[model samples]
Target: MAAFDGSTDYDVTLEIPVSIGGLELPNRLYRAPLLEHAGDDDPVDRLLDELEPCAEAGVGLLMQGATPIRGREGRAAPGMTGFEDPDRVASMSRLTDRIDAHGSRIFAQLAHGGLRSMEVWHAGYRRRNPGLRQRVVSKPPLPLRLADRLGILSIDADPLSTDEVYELAADFGRAADRAAAAGYHGVHLAGATMGIFQQFLSPFYNRRDDEFGGALDDRLRFFEVVHEEIRARTDVPLVTKVPAETETPWFVRESIDAEEAIEACRRLAEIGYDAVVPVGSSPFWDHAIIRGEFGSRGFDDRVSRGFEAAFGGPWRRRLVELAARIDAATTPFEAAWNADLCRRVRAVVDVPVLCVGGIRGRSEADRLLGDACSMVGMARPFYAEPRLAARLLAESDATAVCESCNNCVPPQAVGEPGVCRTPAVLKQRGEFEKRGAYEREGGNRRRDSDGPKL
Candidate 1:
């Protein structure tokens, strides 16, 4: 027998069929979960249009972006859908129908805002609840060790009450049922560190004396119950975006480093998760997820201006800018940034592992699928060009034109559908209207309320 040189199998590895639960994925390239803002956009028609190209491009697996479990409490952005809503189910059905036509397997990536809830920004939903960010944790829990306090882990956000935690678990289970009804092949829990699931799992933000708090087992108790409930409700595949490695050391250290993440993933896989998708700490280590030119935030011509406005003046404005700059500071753009992380994770779990980070084109995909991970997931590149996968598959030498500018991220960050700002997306009034801002043509006018929706 000949020695297996890595290059020989590169072409076929990504093309091979793999099974995710009962769902048979036709290829190794799954579209990373991303927001189409169909929840808030024209809901049905616009989502169909936005997803049409990706489907036509021939991706076999497409994970639709984050949908909140609770309509108001967990909404990270205004446009995010609560799949339970009748209008949303109809819309999801329409979009899923379009995807099925192209022989694609689609899943809804369900999320709960948890502590980072953008409920503060929701216009219709905001007035209903007392503002909770500061009040809930009016006193942010102090990190137990001096080492843990070194970075972004000091975030002072209120912890969910013991009841709220269990309620959230039930919400996720019911949400999964709704996702199945909406024509998705499976449901995904957004356990990435940025959202509530990770918040409950990480000690940095989850400081309470209740059963949901304390040791690692206690922190994960909420998730164990949620996982058990979701599995019982649906037989569809369940995937989770868990931390493989924390991006910046401070946030993912001690309790949940690379070793801890693997251990947790190993246990979760046993608990019934169909696959584990690994993510570096997001937002806090902004550049890790979306790398680009140094300090080049699209905020001035982008979404999130409303966030800046909340600061109210030059001092706060300067502070926000500095924070954004620090968070998004540049890292060298690389191919398959998370391949090694995925390789580490693939070693421990028996379930399929999906790796996504800094994957730009065919070459990177091949590099990643060559054994580092079972699948390669793409997000921003597709946002930059919907035909991204087709282009890569058609030409082995091809690469994405995305500058990795992170422009598309902010839109979905708040809950607006992605808008490619490269050649001026704002200039297209017809396209802009579907995204729910700009009442007229031309980029000349702006809406009375709401930041760019992300």
Candidate 2:
């Protein structure tokens, strides 16, 4: 059988080193940030052993995901670092030190889940309610008015006071300083709809009439100020993942469509973002981002749990499962699902653009790198093969074992690390997590005072 290119092969060795935000990464294969939190409280302890595999695999960079910035305001769940914890900096530095030892550049993905609260804002809602669309809290409740009319998860959020918004921007800068102290090569501030940064941008979440909302430019003030502040604080590279103007359903108040996303990429590029990663859908709503066959099906049990909690008839139970399945369904598996949008972003900015969707094996990656993208990121594939990068460099036909099952995702907030659920991968993940536990108690790793302070 003839491969698409008529050449049954792929290669990463010939790829050129590219500079993003002044950090010249060795190759284009990036270990996309996946939310593999190290249990609830001892993240720093388990991080080194958990991440050592990827660094040893010869990945160009390891982007640790969802490093929360503030205390209550930044955290989405336990195990996430908010940089406010006294011991977090020391723990983060230990993780970075391990990466440095393996010669892999590292970046902490800074984030704050804003209106997207883990705690239900009101008594009526459930945990991290799936689509908590809101109106400005000071104003009359909008989504609440329609809440009973529809079956979607709708709740009210306390809109940030103008003062609070500005303070959040300052927090981002401080967080970047902390990352630098931790020996990271860079930091990618998460501006996804799931985070505070996106809460300020998407009209779905931002409903204020003051300086922070209304027109697109007005809404963008937060992004501009936050990134500028981060630049002021650190010399490390800055990157972000955003919706890229992809249209999301009305119920999901966290995303803006395709054209809006293009404007977003251009605006961020102007503000000195080292790279912009454009995913297939808004970070919160679309199943396409994970490229799941059925709306992140192998995961999203929370959706059903929330629905069951809200309306618990046997009929509701059936409906809940059906809705979750339908909600997460997407197109068939295809490589570079976000390539088109990324190309548009590339045309607008000189900075590198990263496209992540389903760049499964070497072929898809090589194809996109040859086209619009500057780099490629794979999240699920890494779980299937931590050594996938090194393996691919040696064998063009080396494919990742990850079937995009997505079983490792929609993370276990309080429990286990979200490791690959495939039987074979599951076994390996158990062994890895066990060793990570041992390292946590070894008592010789770096402590808070041993690392730099912000």
Candidate 3:
């Protein structure tokens, strides 16, 4: 059934298999978690020695970014990484035996920055709001979004009282059963930037007049009861990352439109959500429009064709012919226009469409496996080459150098960790302080005390 001609170059052992649930991923080229305030409290030998050179750099699905779940004022930092500590699940079983001995499949991005919790980057449990205001309330210079920086540090917000929003929908199904009992080959729900499911799909921090909020079906009824109690506990794999709308007017929200972000991707494809990733966040809504972010680049196939026309489905003409083969790239020249937009978004989405922004090397990872978007996420070139899929299968030019350097999503380096002032991550300050700051309390808002700092 070979029909994907986005331009062909993939063979990390013959690409093609993305399967999610019982973890199949051999190559779709993923390594996008970056946030390296690398899991604190005895973080297993500095996160398996910075993921053993990123699983000897052959990435196939090496996730793990946000982590924190069972509260500690719902962490976002103080150097994140706490799977609600049950004695730190053997630091994720020594990070799943060195990413399954380098074959690659480690998943764990489960976050909870709710209202973007930032007590000077999570110094720990300060949000105790009774709407008593004045924690230093000034806000309005505009760049304050993340539900107004989690309502000026009025944490553990009161609005969630529908039995604490069904006890945070069973604490997101017991934090996805503690990242699938810590073997993790599944569990990516950090619902983009102002995380905590985009602060329960923000209506500017859900004023919650009940059911959950006022509209957008009561703000996706607490994410459909935390995706039906984390898909009823778990068969592993879930991956959600939404927010193409509703955040102080970015993707232009009218009660979270685009048919409610395609009815929240047809309710994460009716709850068996294997993958969804859409992300786009620079104006305060989980951004979605990909790299350029002002809007339009296959904005997840015109918003998954409004969730394939509200689930009438035929995969909505394969997600609008993979957004006209990723709007036939007018720029980002090379890697055959990203394998013809991943062979025109895998010729219409049978479930694989991945691609995340400004890819790094191996000719954009061989046009991201010659254009079929099964995987190729790359958060800021894995904080300036974390062995980027092993220097792109050793064709090395330092994997065609990624000096784009926005300095991997800044925000005061969350408390400082992912320090790649380039020069190859500053010749390892003890592996950049044991691999930190991929983005825990960094850029999602903080510079405006009086604005100046660029």
lDDT of 1 by residue, 99-217 (tens): 88776778888887664565433333444455534213113434322312432222334555667667668878888887787788898888874677776666665666888777877
- List lDDT for all candidates, in order: 0.64, 0.64, 0.53
TM-score of each: 0.80, 0.79, 0.31
Off by over 4 Å in 2: 1-15, 121-156, 245-247, 250-255, 283-286, 294-320, 330-332, 410-415, 424-454
- Give the per-residue lDDT digits (tens) of candidate 2, residues 245-339: 36465565555777788778877787777789876555353355675645244445664454345443345556544754675563456667788
Cα error, candidate 3, residue 254 (Å) = 7.1
The residue-by-residue lDDT of candidate 3 on 1-454, one tens digit each, is 3333444444422233455554676556677776677656677677776665666555667776777675454555546777766658645776786677667777887776654554322222343322231111112123344423533222333334567668767877887777777677777777767665665665654555666767666666766787678778777877766555422344433334334554564455454566665543422422233232122322343344433332234444354335434432322223222333334434433344455656666555554544445566766566555665544544433343444434333332234465345555455423533554221221112112332100
Question: How many clashes (backbone N, Cα, C below 3 Å) per candidate?
Answer: 3, 10, 23
Better of 1 and 3 by lDDT: 1
lDDT, model 2: 0.64
Best by TM-score: 1
Clashing pairs in 2: 68-82, 245-257, 245-258, 245-261, 246-257, 246-258, 294-328, 294-329, 295-328, 295-329
